[model samples]
Target: MQLSFLNLASNNLSGKVPDCWARWPYIVGVNLGNNHFTRILQTSMSSLPLLEMLNLRNNSFSGNLPSFLKNGSSLVSLDLGENQFSGMIPSWVGQSLSNLKILVLRSNKFSGPIPHQICNMSVLQILDLAHNELTGYVPKCVNHLSAMLVINNSLESYIYFPVSGGQLLVEPLLLKERVYDYSSNLGLITSIDFSNNELSGEIPTELTGLKRLHFLNLSNNHFIGQIPQNIGNMESLETMDFSRNHLTGTQIQSFEASSFVGNYDLYGPPLNNSCSSNSSSNKEEVHHVKGINWFFVSMAFGFIVGFWAVVGPLLYSSSWRYAYFQFIDRMWYKLQYRCYW
Candidate 1:
């Protein structure tokens, strides 16, 4: 029977998504995750031109990404994590599906550079490309993610049925290190997970511009260099993991050892390694402080000597001291007489 929503998740269902889905022209949501399905996804998926959400996580779907998704302009959430899908993530992902807000491809065999063209998806908020063999530096254009740069508390990413005018079924979101179904508050979640890959290079400083980002995971990679100096600028960050990489820096606040474990070059609080530079710098500062103290002492001594030199002869000579006091007293009496008269 034709349906607008189909959910067969966590079942014994196997093999490819049925060819019958093509007949469901009104289909808006499809979930077949956690199954034993194998082999290639049918190109018939192109038949459902209005398909909005597709979940194939924890399946055995293999081979290169099917270009059939190019026709799925209405797609907003696509999850293919924990699969065997290989090959580069298509550039068309950002070119065609501009409305997509959530994209997950974790634990896949996909490799090659993450296309900078994907930065074109201004509305994409949650992106998980971890647990892959992907190599190359992260795209510096990450600041282009406009949706993640702002706090969204609405349900703008929800799927809606065209005919009924009612909201469609909710989709699963992997957030805060777990999977949860987000129904009415999907827009509030913003995160990026690119850990456990061969991705190398410095973490882009531009990523700190994602002020509304709530979670970030860049652990278990080949990243080098210090963590971005302004990483604390991500004020909305609630959870982050940068462990098992080659990162070098002092311990970041609000993070624990697990977040930086396996990173030998990093030091400071939360890590057993102390920053020896801190001690040496303190010693140098002590010498500078001592020099400043002696300079102040010399200024005070010179002022005292100069003051006594000018007044010592007047005090020793009784006649000069009497004359000086008499002059001061005469001036004071004259000023008082002028005021009273």
Candidate 2:
């Protein structure tokens, strides 16, 4: 009998994945999640080239990522979250799993900076690495995620693998702040979750370019600096979380106060703290007032000096004053005659 699907989830199955299952060449999806599966996966992996979806979440899988992941280049969705898996996320992930549209490694012991090579996943639409021990800056090259940047109208966008019974499912993803089941409308949903880690640095402004992205979570981390001012450009963003960080800025009108809580340094509307009215404005006002006072005093002094100079001269020389009046009267009459003509 040819087998194409297996669901051994929530069974408390112990020990490594069975070696016998490798002989099933037609198998496309495997679910061993919610089990006590432990120890290293054996060489049976090389036998399953057609495997597309693998879920080993909520397990005791330990040590480095399996090389079979590299072997399974045909994979479209992979979930290893909620595992005891340690060590850095392999660079080979980007190199081998280039076809991956959804990748989740949250709630693991994985550490170190995210590899820049991850930008190579041009079709990757959902990435969740929250609740890990990861450190270092969020890779700025993440702007290279083309799938999130452009709208995918293709009918083949949803993740599904053919099975004897039906297509095997990709489970609903639980992010740090939200749970998204992109099963029906996968192509229309794009999100990135890097919250609850040791990740530090300014949230990259480049992320605003993902105009089709619907959700983003960078909360519960050490990220510093103001939220990107152009974040409003992410028109598709329906959910976002930047809480429990050092983020400081004016509150964006698009998001509610809950989206930015735990950021003690941040001040704006939606939060109780108003933007501080600083002394700079007062100082400027004082300086302007002083300048205007000085200008008026200078103008008044000039008027008095000019009046005294001309009037004193006129008083001392009646002939000059009389000549000046005669000249003014002749010019006024000549101007009126020209206007009448």
In the range 20-66, model 2's lDDT, one tens digit per residue, is 86678877888888899896565776678888888888889998888
CA RMSD, predictions in order: 21.9, 21.7
Question: What do the candidate models score in CA lDDT, each in turn?
Answer: 0.82, 0.82
> What are the clashing pairs of model 2?
none
- Positional deviation of 175 in candidate 1, in angstroms? 5.4
lDDT of 1 by residue, 1-341 (tens): 66878778889977766566667887888878888999655468887877888888898999988777888888988888998999998888889888888888998999999999889988897899988998999999998998878765666644444533455344465653577765555567788999889999999999998988988999889999998989888878988888989887776967877898888778887876666865566577899999999999999999999989869969799988889999999999999999999
lDDT of 2: 0.82
TM-score of 2: 0.77
Lowest summed lDDT across 10 adjacent residues in model 1 is found at 162-171
lDDT of 1: 0.82
